[model samples]
Structures are given as C-alpha cells and as structure tokens.
Target chain A: MSSFEVPEVSNKQVIFKNYVVGKVNDSDLEIRTSQLRLELPEDGTNDVLVKNLYLSPDPYMRSRMKEDYTSYVPPFTPGKPIDGYGVSKVVLSKNPAFKEGDYVTSFTRWEEYSVIPGGNGLKVIDTSESVPLSYYVGCLGMPGFTAYVGLYEILKPKQGETIYVSAASGAVGQLVGQLAKLAGLYVVGSAGSQQKIDLLKEKLGYDVAFNYKQETDYNAALKKYCPKGIDMYFENVGGKMLEAVLDNMNKFGRIAVCGLISQYEKENSDGIHNLSRLISARITMRGFLQADHANLQPEFLQKMLGYLKEKKFVYIEDIDEGLESAVGAFVKLLSGGNVGKQILKVATD
Target chain B: MSSFEVPEVSNKQVIFKNYVVGKVNDSDLEIRTSQLRLELPEDGTNDVLVKNLYLSPDPYMRSRMKEDYTSYVPPFTPGKPIDGYGVSKVVLSKNPAFKEGDYVTSFTRWEEYSVIPGGNGLKVIDTSESVPLSYYVGCLGMPGFTAYVGLYEILKPKQGETIYVSAASGAVGQLVGQLAKLAGLYVVGSAGSQQKIDLLKEKLGYDVAFNYKQETDYNAALKKYCPKGIDMYFENVGGKMLEAVLDNMNKFGRIAVCGLISQYEKENSDGIHNLSRLISARITMRGFLQADHANLQPEFLQKMLGYLKEKKFVYIEDIDEGLESAVGAFVKLLSGGNVGKQILKVATD
Candidate 1:
C-alpha cells in the first residue's frame, strides 16, 4: 500500500477505563472499536502510520496503571489507549527514515492501528529469516538489553563467581542467568513453580534451580542452593526474596535491582528485615532503567544476534492472540500466571 | 628513655570478660593490673612500645565484642586486653620511624602501656602546636577519614545538592555535615536528643537538625527537614531512619551506608518497608569501609588540616577520665548517653 492509499477500517483498541488499586482484574480494561482511515495526514511529514503486530505485557505496566505513582516512566492516562513496547508493520510513512512494508519497533498503543510520531524511541527492525519478529518486543528487545546492562555493567561478573537470580524464568531473569553462565560463573535461579524451575535448569542451563513456592524458608532455600555464598544477585522479585538473598550474599557482593514484581500490586509493600546485612557484607545495590541505556543497543543487538544464531541463548514466550486477550494476559502477568515473556499478538502479518 | 632501658611497671588494663548479646553492659569488661617491662623485645626490629594517652569509644567496637563476627577488623579476644584506635606517646622504639617522646597513633589496647608492631596502620602525629593530641583519636583519626571517603569517594557530592545524615552530632556525622556544607550543599541531620540537635544546628552549621525521639512519624520528620527531597543520605543509624530516608529520596539519589548502629544491638532487626523506591527513583546504595580508601588519605589530611587550622571545622568531645570509666562510657555510647565523640582519657600528655 502507498502512503496515499486510504481504507476505512475498524480499529480495535484496549482502553484504560480507570486507575487501578491492589490486584488488577480484566474488568479494568475494555476493548472498543473505532473507525480509522488508514492514510497519512496531508501535513504528516514526520509521522508513520503502523499496523500493530505484537504488544508486550510487562510488570512495569502495573506501575503505569496506578492513578498517582512516581517512576522512571509516566503513568497511563485514564480513558486513553494503553501504550507500550510493540512490534508493528508500517503501512503508510511520510517519514524519510521509514518506508512502506518496513517492520519497526516503537512505543505504540494497544490498538490494531497506531499513528506514531517520528523522532526518538523508534527503531526499524532487521527482518532476518532466522529469528521470529515477535522476539523484537522480547528476547531481542527491552528485556534483553536490560539483562545485558545489569549483568555486564552493574554486576561486573567475574569468572567462577556465584550468581543468584529471583524470578529466574521470567524474560529478563532467564537471560541474566544464561549470560552469567556464558561468562563462566556458577548460576542459581528461583521461580514460583516446579515447572518453571525445571525449565530454568533443563532449558536455561542454570546450575541449580529451585521452586520458591515449595520452600518453607526462603533463607534456607538460598543457603542450600548457593552454598559458597552469592556474589551477585539479579533482583527481579523484591520483598522477602531480597531479604533472603541479602542473608546469603558474600562479602563485597553486588545486587542489580531490575524489578520488584512482588510488591507492584500490593497497596502496602512488605518490609525487608535483612537490609542491615548489606552493611555487614559490604554490598552494592543499584537500580536502573533500560531506557537510560539506549547507547548500548547496537552492541547489545550484535552480541544477542550472535548468541541467537549460534543457539547459545534460549527464549520462551506465552503469546496470547487478539487485542481482547491483552487485558487478561496483563493481569495474569502480575499474578505470575503466565510463564516466560507474556506477549499479545494484535494482528497477523 | 632509651630503647634498651627496662622499667618494671604495674600496668592497669581493661580486659574483655566474654561475648556480649544485645546492649553491652558495664559488667562485660573488667579491669586488671599486670606487670610490664618497658623495653623492646629481643631481636625485635619493628616493635614500638608506647604509653597510651586517649582511647576512642566507637560504635564499631560493639561488633568487635561479638564472639565470631566477620568484618574488616577482627573481633577482640575474650580474656585479653581490648584494642581500639588511640593516641599514644612513644616510650621505646626499635623501628627507625619512631623515637622516644614522639607521639603516634595506632590500634592500641585499653591500657597504660602497649607494644605495637610498627609497619602498617601506624602514623606518627605531626605534633602541630595548633591541634590538640586528643583530636587524633576523634576528628583526625578513623572517624574523620571515614566521613571523607564516604562523601567524596562514594556519594560523590556536588554543589547545591541536599544531604541528610543520621546521628548527625557524633564524631563522623558532625564532620560529614560540615564538610558537605563547605562543599556548598544544603545539609540536614537527625539525632536522638534535643541537645545533640542543638549542637548540630548551632555549632556544626547544619541547615536543619531534628531530634528523632520527639517525632511521632519518621517519614513526616524527613519531609519537614528535607523539603526538597534528599539527594544524598549518609546512613548511620539504620532500620526506621533508613526506611524514612528512602521514602523521601529524589530521583537518581545516592545512599552511602556508613554504619547501622541501631541494628547492631538488636537480635532481630527492624524491617525497612520502602526499599522499592530504589527502583522508581533509580537510586544507588553502597556499603563501604574506610580501610579500602587509604590512597585518598594524603589529600584528605591536607584539606582536613587546613580546615582545622582555619577554624572551619568544629569538633566536640565528651572526655571520660581513666580506664575505670571506659566500660561505662562504652555502654553509654551504645545507648546515645554520651554527647559528641566519647573518649576515655587514659592519661594526660
């Protein structure tokens, strides 16, 4: 289709009905159909009209659902389309950088069609035959870059060092464990279910994987898994996991605080009692956002692409079909109902 | 006295009775008299025998009283003389670095006389007419160097930033406030009593100081003092104070974990409920030891000596007389009973 070709189509969008509190339910989001003329505006010089293909359901989206919250990213506006990282196919482009039939990744709304303003935060995806296009929003995208920066930059992993990762089968945690193992470190991981633990050990190549749900004592579990003591901790689920990891950390250990998924849905967060151990063990804990690390994308893509081609990295996605399933998929993500990266397939290419 | 001269003297020493639990009491230590020959050992080329002048009663010493604690410094042996940072007058020296009548500072025991091995951790006092000898055990000693490294090296304070310090009127806190102020930053400090709060505001030049004992809610107290939100927090008394500080920290804030005096005496530590703020605010919290930054001492000394000479830095000391008062002073230090830096005046130079 040319930039001037217009078509009257029904655009289905997932709208944010109201601000959420406590646990999110599917009723919080409502799908509405609106008619959109699929064509560029007359003065659209730097805009790209894209057809959304896949939408990502991330834990960070939970923070954005709150009415009033302070975070690295802004909260979603009520009554507006929920926007997040998505893989889209450009149908009409007035921007010189993007052409018709080019697959691009950008922050797009949870709608079948989206008009994204050109500038920053837009990347044209390389359509390679080896990898799936949906992976752009997951393993090869934000989560992958997060794991790279956290392990290499923040943790500064050394060979033979021991690493412990919480929520170990999640998108970022899976990559963190694999990257640490590739760096010649002993890696241990914890997940919510036995199936996830099995996947972490069998598929992800983790040295040891434990189901946190089965362990009566989190501290004892950490001690059993990381016998020599944890040198680096990839903190995904905070609260008790953070406290337990602190107790098992070695002297001069480092903790990369990527996400606190456990406390995201709670009105009042659980208290971490073992924080004083950070002092006794002389630990360094730092929190970071992947958006701040855009400069490393090229390097991250090159290495990740190589690992993917060589079959050295493994990724799994629990993809839900259609925009109607997005709301349910997101709620399931916060409740740990979905395994691996939870993605919404909006439209088929 | 010559290095070969021997004198039979009855040396009164304070000995550690046993391992302590919870708060330290006066009964945990006992005074004993032992005969000592004030002469260098046979073929001892690097030994220096000295007469103890002043001994510092620090919070870190509380951890040393535990039976099998792991730290940068080892625990004090039970049924032996307790060792700590002290100022001493050299009585005999086999090392060329020291001679009789020269004042030196080292990790000396709580006794009238001590024989210290000479090479490392010992620095000869400049014997400047401007500063008092007792200052070596407080401001110009371990605590002083600790503040310098934490603020300049770790926190990396910039001008016009806001800083909050807990236990603000003590040895390290008072100096940290003054140094931060000199660096052109707004500083706030919190102490346990009104007297210490007044000392911080009136004498130490803190922009704001609060008595945490009077505050019904710690988070509200932090908001009142640090209205701009804390840019850097010098953590000393941890537990509740740390939780409150974390709640009020600005985006990209830094926390330098110096000591957790509140948790040191507790069998089970209080939980910190606001650690999740580290992720939203992109905070970096690191625990450090002063021994790791020996290379920065030369620059620290030059600047600190200048500040002392120019009357830009003010230090206060609660001097307790004799080794008999040492036990009471140490117990008092743990309970915040003594003001400023608590020190035992073993003997007057």
Candidate 2:
C-alpha cells in the first residue's frame, strides 16, 4: 500500500566548547546536526538509539566544568557533548532488554538522538496519568530523592524541630520544605527574591519564607525567624547564609549540605568563619550526593506518586522549549533566575 | 601502727572570684576550708565520702567564664569550685552499691574532699597494671574517649586519608594523631609553638607538623603540606585554623570539632569567613562531647588497653601538686601553656 522513502538521517546534538571560566555564556554551547542516522549503529552488541524528549538543566552540571576531582563523582570529559539527566524513548534497540517503544530515563547528551549501551545508562519508568511524564525529572526523580535523603536520612529531623533551608524556591529546596512540613517540623526557608518567597509560601507551602536579598543581615534574619534556635539546616546556597545558620543552631543540630549555587561561578569562593559553632552546638553536618540515595528511589517514587495522585503535592516547572534554549536556561538556573526545576523540552512528539 | 586522728573536717571549699573575663589569673581563685565534717549526713540515702586524689584541669572549664546560651555543656556556677573529671578513693558509702577502699572517677569539684551521691556520681575503676592510675583521667579517660569517637566514628576516616589536627600537642589532638596513624592514615598536625610542633612530630609521631604561630599565612601553610587536599580535619583551636582548613579541604572532607580553645576566652568571638567552603567541599563537619560517646566506651577501653600494653601509645601529664595550685594549672591549660593533659594532685597519699 505504501512504498516509504527512508527517513532523512540528521541527528541534532548539543556540543560543549572548551571549559567555561566565569559566568557561562550561550556561546559556550552550540547545536550542531550530524549526518548519522537516528538508528542504532550496527555494532554486534547491546546498544540502543534514544530520542531524547526532556533534558534536565541541573545546578550540579557546573561542577563538570571544573578539572579537579570531587569526592565520589567524576567530572565530565570536555570536547564532547556534556550529558546529564534526561527523559527519552527507545527508538531502536540492538539489545532485547529495551523494546522499540518504551519510556526511560538516562544520562544522555543534550541531543535529539543518541546511541548508548543498554545495561549501564538506562532506567525504565512505568508511566501513569496521575502526573505529567516530565515530573520524572523533578518531583519523582533525582531532585526529589535529593530532598528526601538530605532531610530524612542526613538531618534525621524530629517532630517539632525547627528547620531552615536555603534556596527555598529552587527545585531541591522547594521539595525539602514540603517534606519538612509533612514531618510536622517548624520550617523556614530563604529564597533569592520576593516573588520566589511568595511562591515558597503560597504554592510550595513553607511555614516561613524570607527573601535573603531583602534581609540586610542573615544572622539578624535567622534570629528573627528561628527565635529559639534551628535544629536542622538544609544548606543549599552557601556563604553568609551558612554562617548565620551556624550561630542560631540548637544543641545537637544537624546540617545537610546539598549545594552552593552562589559560589559555583566565582574563582575564589567565600569563606565562613563560625564553623566553631558546630562544636559549641554539638551539631552534626553532613554532605551528600543524590546518587548515594538510589536505594531510596523506590520509596521516593511510591510516596511522591501517591502524593501527586492524591493532589496533595504541587511542583513548579520552569520549562524552556527547544535544544537551542538549553544553554540559556542552564545559566539562569545557576543564577537563581528560575524558580523551580529547570527543564528543557527537546520535542513533544 | 601510729594512731591517726581523723583529719579535722573543715567543710569549706574553693570559691571563684567574679566571672573570669580574659586570661584567668591565679588571684581569681581562693581556697577556704569549711567547718563541715567529712562524714556524710546521717539520713543521706545515696551519699558517699570521696577523698579527691587527682582532678583534671580541662580547657572547657574556661567556657564557664561566659554566660552565653551557646554553650553545649552547661557552664559551671560562678563562685563555686569548678567541676570536672577527677579520681578519688571512697572512704564511706551510705549506698550499698559502693563501699570503702574503692577507687572511682567522678565529675567532682576542684577540692581535697567531696561528699557525692553514690548513685549519681562515680564509676569504680578496676585496678589493673595495664596503665598508670592517673591515666584514668588522661589516656583512658575523657581525652582518650574523645579521640576514639571523633577520629573513628564521626570522621570515619579511610586508610591513607589525609588528616590535619589543630593543637597537635594538646590532650585530644595528640591522641587523634596517634590513632589516625594507627588507622593507616597520613596525619598532619598544627601546634602554637616550635616546641609543640617538634613534640607533635617526634613524640606524637605525626607525619607532617607545623607551628601555626610561626606561619604568617595559615592557608599557605595548609596548601604547602596538603597538596592533594585534606580528607579529615580534627578541630580544636577553632578560629583562623578552621578558616584555613576549610580552604584546603577536599570534597567530602570530614571535620570533627572537639574544642574551640582559642575562642573560649574572647567575649565576642571573631567571625570566621571561610565556613561556606563546607558546601563547595561537600564537607561533613560535626561537633561532639565525649560524654555522649558512652556507647563506644567498651570498644575504646579494649583498643586503648591493647595499645597501652604494647607500648604503642605514650601519654604526657603536666601534674600540678596540691589542690591550691589547681586554679593556676587550669589557667595555663586555657592559655595553651600546658604541654600535655593538665592534672591536679589533691591528696596522692
């Protein structure tokens, strides 16, 4: 009935230039089209072709630009397409593990088409109408897991404990506050702007939200909010905020250091002096990466999906369309321009 | 046997004059004997008579000078003799659990004689030839337990991890270095003077030792020694050393804050601006008191006794004879003049 013309094999990929030094420019990235077909290459082993639909512009991606080693995580190799968390659909599979039409989450390059090994980089997602599929990158994914593990596992927040989170309206911070609220904690959060603070209070449901920019002195602000003292601090934005939090922490307080967007672009980072407060308060401060919480993924997804289904949870998504806007969106995410999870939409179909 | 009249029971005790403001003076303390008898009150239920033998002159006693609520441990009541770890011989016990002629340790006041609750204070020490009796207050006591938990549990040091201990010749710092070395770690220590640095290197067996007093720039000194960056930092003298350590720490570096002796005397402590490094470095910095590590006591004693029996551990004591000299010894400990664990001999007979 139909003699089909072979589909034009033009693969569009996002390429990274030589490592960015200071504030990352859009010119640091270029979208180039490759003549290679979207089909999986005829390598004899298990490789699959994926049509990337959603790409995550995470703050930690900035770490890949640095050359030095950071704990258990390795820096991404330059001169190649930088890869991060993305939602994709399997187009063709040389391996039997994934079928021709299955939704999956993978660490793939910023591209419309990619070929990756079947076993290592792919995780299958069971979809439902309860929430949007893009939520796999936010609430039910890495960011949500990061919030859960950092708050519950690291901080071990007890009921009625006072909790403070920086970057309150950011992807991770927003979820952290909600979870803290669910745990019956007295929660306060710091955001970059009044709009974000309002969003944190009205949309995300933080007990108290303060625009750090409006607050002249962080210590005074902490004293005002906490009054008695903070029992747990979810540290995301470092610098003066951390110093302030340290001074107001209760005895045996806990701090879970998740990120530091403030100094990610700076050459010489700011120093905090009041760390001695850790001893005086007998605080336990721990740093954790989300990958360490893989074991909690099942529990995280089950709980988050249940919340979404019950309409008890609200998540904000700052979606930037097309691969061309990925670089700009990523820069904005780092600069705290975006309120929530920054997701770049590659294609709808 | 020569007939001995029971020592005339003067019930008076030492009194602290005013709250210690700056460096404690010998004149700040005055010893006065009271007309109270050594015998416990006739109706006492849990009372015991303890003739004080050895009392510890610890650095934390200096915190009692301040009225700040930031204190993790409660401050000693002013105008009363300071209380800390002490070794004593029981003379009488109204409580049946303890009896006469038993050697015990208690948080007793800095005085020759003390009547304590048998149930409330004191742990009987089984006399063993493994170590000296005074070792109970030094090596096998608070300092030793502190080093054990902070280095092993809190830091969770990996073999070959680079560890830096401040106040390397102090009671806790000295043991931290030794235990770190035994754990197959690369240890570096910083002390205030050249003599202390030499002691850290030669007697304490630290891999690299520095005199913080001689070094103009602490950050430069840290970078020079820790080229690969520090993995664990044992904080004692917190202020500038903490700031410098933060700058040089590797990602996921752990800091166990045991004491902040340098800031204890200051009314308004100096601001350390380098604390934000914890987020960038992804450091896990915790503060602890040794009394909280009671669960690990058995393990600590076993390991410490093994080390002591093999002569793998060596302890130094700065012993001040008589109860009257106790106040001066405490002042020296806070001023960093004492070479090792400061001890006060009460009776010794």
Give the per-residue lDDT digits (tens) of candidate 2, residues A1-349.
1224335467777788867677887888777877655554466778988888999999888877777635455676666788888889988888777887788888888888788875357877786544676888888888888998998889998899899999988889989999899899998999889889899889888888888889969999999988778999998877778888888899899989888778678776666666667777788888787776688888888888888878776999999999888888987888889978899999885
lDDT of 1 by residue, A247-289 (tens): 8899999999999999988898888876767777889999988
Mind giving the per-residue lDDT tens digits that candidate 2 earns over B1-349?
1225445565546677667676688887778776545566557578988888998888877777666534645766767876778898888788787889888888787777787865466888888654667889888999889999998888998997899999888888889999999999999998878878888888888999988888869999999988778999998888777888988998778889888888877765666654546655667888988777799999898889989889887887889888778777877888888888888888874
Best by TM-score: 1
The CAPRI-style docking tier of model 1 reads medium
lDDT winner among the candidates?
1
- In candidate 1, which residue pairs get closer than 3 Å at backbone N, Cα or C atoms, i.e. clash? none
What TM-score does structure 1 among the candidates reach? Answer: 0.91
Candidate 1 contains a number of clashing pairs equal to: 0
Cα error, candidate 2, residue B306 (Å): 6.5
Q: Which stretches of model 1 miss by more than 4 angstroms?
A: A1-7, A37-47, A94-96, A117-120, A128-130, B1-8, B32-48, B92-98, B117-121, B128-130
Return the top candidate by DockQ: 1
